[model samples]
Target: MSEFEWLKRAHAYDEADAEDLEGRVIAALRTVYDPEIPVNIYDLGLVYALDLDEDAGRVDLRMTLTAPGCPVAQTFPGTVEEAVRSVRGVDDVHVELVWEPPWSRDRMSDAARLQLGML
Candidate 1:
């Protein structure tokens, strides 16, 4: 295949002409750590969903904290929103905190469980 074709395959989102910007989203997500935990919020299982709107250059996230009464409830959503907004291609970010399904230890990423030595 040609170099241009390879480039498209490497970075282009199947839905768009622009580069897939998910990496930037993850990079920014790494900067947000749970206030009471040592792990990045992403690994903590706090983030339940991430949707990138290629056409709009927007990102939306649905997440939960360890507990419904988590002390950082207010701050956590703000932090994640800020992180997402910092990504270069992100035109806007909206973080929603949900407690309906709740958060549990099982939700944690392997890395998070390992960091906490729960492995």
Candidate 2:
């Protein structure tokens, strides 16, 4: 293939592959539960971002707790890291705690709201 054609094909494949990796990362995150909440972190609106480097099997995640002073504050990030690392093809996980645009009920998924009886 010409360089132009190769670049085009690679770009398309990267988008699709990135999406698939992101899906898997989200799935893994959904399996993580907040110590005080029945809902998983993903649905609870705690996850602010999930960035994947599929070729490197690395994931860069940004998340937060319901509150800055949450009882599990010190351990939650580690928990999330372990959960994401457990997913197949995810060789490395970086979980960052973000307070910007702090988490709120409005951020929760509709299903999470219903489950929490807020709906």
Candidate 3:
């Protein structure tokens, strides 16, 4: 098989693979939970945006903590970046925190809702 074949195999990650990968990445994210919250940040409505930079094998993530004054604000960003870096194929992980819109319970994923018994 040629290098192109391998590239093709990966360049366009199928939906199932993408979902699997997202799940895996989120699982890794779960390992680093908020110090003040019972739930992992992944499901805590903190992760607001994600951009898969496939060509660079990097993932750019945008998120916000439950509160700006939260105690782990400094440590959590590094933790989030590291968590994403553990995912296979992600050469670099950039987790940026945005506060314009602010974080709220509505942003939580359905899985998170179930975990909190909100759904």
Best by TM-score: 2
Q: Give the Cα lDDT of each candidate.
A: 0.74, 0.79, 0.71
lDDT of 3 by residue, 41-70 (tens): 877878888777666877888889888898
Better of 2 and 3 by TM-score: 2
Over the stretch 1-119, how does candidate 2's per-residue lDDT look in tens digits?
85334433434433444447777667667767788889988999999988889899999999999889898888778878876776657799999998898888888999998998999
* Pairs clashing within candidate 1: none
Q: What lDDT is obtained when candidate 2 is compared to the true structure? A: 0.79
lDDT-best of 2 and 3:
2
Model 2 weakest lDDT span, ten residues long: 4-13
The pairs that clash in candidate 2 are: none
lDDT string for model 1 (1-119, tens) is 95334433433343243245776676566666787889987778788889999679899999888888889887778867866775657788989999968788887889999999999
- List the candidates' TM-scores in order: 0.79, 0.81, 0.73
